[model samples]
Target: MPALDDLSLLIEAARRSGEIATSFTGKTAQRWDKPDDAGPVTEADLAVNAMLHQTLTAARPDYGWLSEESDDGTRRLGQRDLFIVDPIDGTRSFIEGSDTWSHSLAIARDGRITAAVVFLPMLDRLYAAAAGAGATLNGQSISVSDIATLPEATVLATKPVMEMQHWTKGDPGFKRAHRPSLAYRLGLVGQGRFDGMVTLRKSWEWDIAAGALIVTEAGGQCTDRTGQPLRFNNPDPRLNGVVAGGDAVHAALLSGLAQTQATP
Candidate 1:
């Protein structure tokens, strides 16, 4: 199928999943965490997972599946194309009544993402992208911020990671803040609302896959803090961390990350 065909499918499934998610937001739902302490998963997450699995699988059984709420089997490793998903990217935000949660979905072939869609139900905004095609918000095209440096740049990052201790040169003095949703944080960077986003903990593929593509397609860059490209559908679907921003800033940010992560 064409890239747009895959994109269309992702957008449809994301919107449908977003609708299902909205229904359970204000209502009560069962919630729990994995024995491994991965994070919380609510009834809404499972419901959306099932709906999206059915929606995508029924249309493309040959495609493999990788989902936050589903079992991670070895089957996906052999498929040429697969779906990477987070039923709801920000369960914490969603449970807290924050509107930043999202339904993040993407299609990856080989090791690269080809199509993606992120839907924020409460905000009524949809972000979508197809390989070699520009990104869009709702229906209009979007791009990363033009800001070329970090001084006073609006950034999304965990407090400690953004601290002066990590910056060897001195704190970049970013206008930093925390965003509960990883996907939404990335989406914000893609929308030019944030100059950059960073994290220093392990990041799941399902959490960053869609957002990575969206950020890149928006004329920004995304990769592990060590300056490595993110590849999906691997036996291990997690990354050490991610840093994303427009070209010049992204390069500079990586240098800071290198110093921060460097051993004393």
Candidate 2:
């Protein structure tokens, strides 16, 4: 476990970054695009990235850094502690003047996440968790809902046509709701706002590293669609797939999807 001082410092840094992101939410000039047609990246993202990189590097000078807006450097592999970050996890929503986006931060030790913070600046909600200490939203402890069945679950989904095809063909009873950002969807699960969330595409480490810990500590399960635990610091840095929710709801989801596939 990290010292309280260290965690507090990280939290403060994240809060500061969140404030930077919020300052550009409704502004028109901060939005831009990343190279390689990767989608949008805003001035707010770069600003927050610079802020986080500076603060975290200053705090733990030895830790390697990985972030959405920065180039990847393998130097992090030699260090036991590394900072993985997404300055703006939902840049599209941020650019569109919506409040669904957020800032995601996590510390990985030896390839496992040891601590995480997902801050939604527009909502003034901060979700934080340290290993073995549980998770919290805005200083209040949070957890997943007790829904146990697919029919009873309120599923947050992405890319409607694709994800819906994957789910409906696999589970007739499962219901779906749409949310764009993976971090926001997972945060909702942690806060008990949604019963579960499913994403079918490969997501970046910065996208789910913090969100996974948030859901796990909130008494929900987060794993690859194959029901395996998630690992970080990979060379690819992309999660293959994600299935997250309360224990029983997660189990029911896996079973329902499997049964639907097996029938006929």
Candidate 3:
């Protein structure tokens, strides 16, 4: 199918996922820990995941599947196309009654994301993109900020990423902000709400896949913290890290990251 056709599917799937997720919000749906300390997962997450999995895979049974709430296996590795999803990208925030959480969905073909959507139902924000088609939010085109320099950039990052030792010379001094959802941070960058975003910790493919495509299609650049281009559906299904921004800002973040001793 054409990437845009796939994008249409993703957009609809994301909306349904959002509805399933939000139904459990403000009221307790069961929550618990994963065996590997991978963070929390609630009943809402599973419900959304199940709906997305059944609806999407049934529509494209030839494609593979990888989801945060599902068991991981090598089956996805054999397919040329597959779904990479995080039914609820910010379970903790959802559990805490925060509205910033999102449902992230993407279709990866031959290791590249071709169609993607990140939806925050509570906020009514929907960011969507198809490879080579640019990006949009709520049906309006969006682009990255024009800021070119690091000092003038307003970046989204966790507090630990701002520590002095993470920079080669010293603090780069860009204003730092944060969001509980990695997908949301990337969406904000794509929407031009922030100049950039950084996460030096190893990131999950399901978490970053959709957002990465949205940022790039919006005229921003996205890569691993080491400045490598991102490739999805790997055997491990995890990335070294993520750094995304407008052209100049992305370069600056990579240069600073290279000087640090950190490894993701």
User: Which lDDT value does model 3 have at 154?
Assistant: 95
For residue 107, model 2's alpha carbon misses the true position, in angstroms, by: 0.6
Clashing pairs in 1: none
Q: Assess candidate 1 and give its lDDT.
A: 0.87
Q: Could you give candidate 2's per-residue lDDT for residues 1-264 as a string of tens digits?
A: 473455677689888987787776455846766677789887888999999999889989988899999999777767888889998887888888887788888988888878888888888888888888888988899999999787778888754423445653544465678766787788889999999987766778899988898899899999877687898988878876788999998886665453222110
> Candidate 2 clashing pairs?
none
**TM-score of each candidate?**
0.95, 0.91, 0.97
The candidates, ranked best first by lDDT, are 3, 1, 2
Better structure of 2 and 3 per lDDT: 3
Task: Give the poorly placed runs of model 3, Cα more than 4 Å off.
Answer: 259-264
10 residues in a row with least lDDT, candidate 3? 255-264
User: For each candidate, what is the lDDT?
Assistant: 0.87, 0.81, 0.92
Candidate 1 lDDT over 36-112, as tens digits, reads 76778899999999999998999989999999999989999999999999999989778888888899999999989
Which structure is stronger by lDDT: 1 or 2?
1
Ranking by TM-score: 3, 1, 2
Model 3 clashing-pair count: 0
**Ten-residue segment with the worst summed lDDT in candidate 2?**
255-264
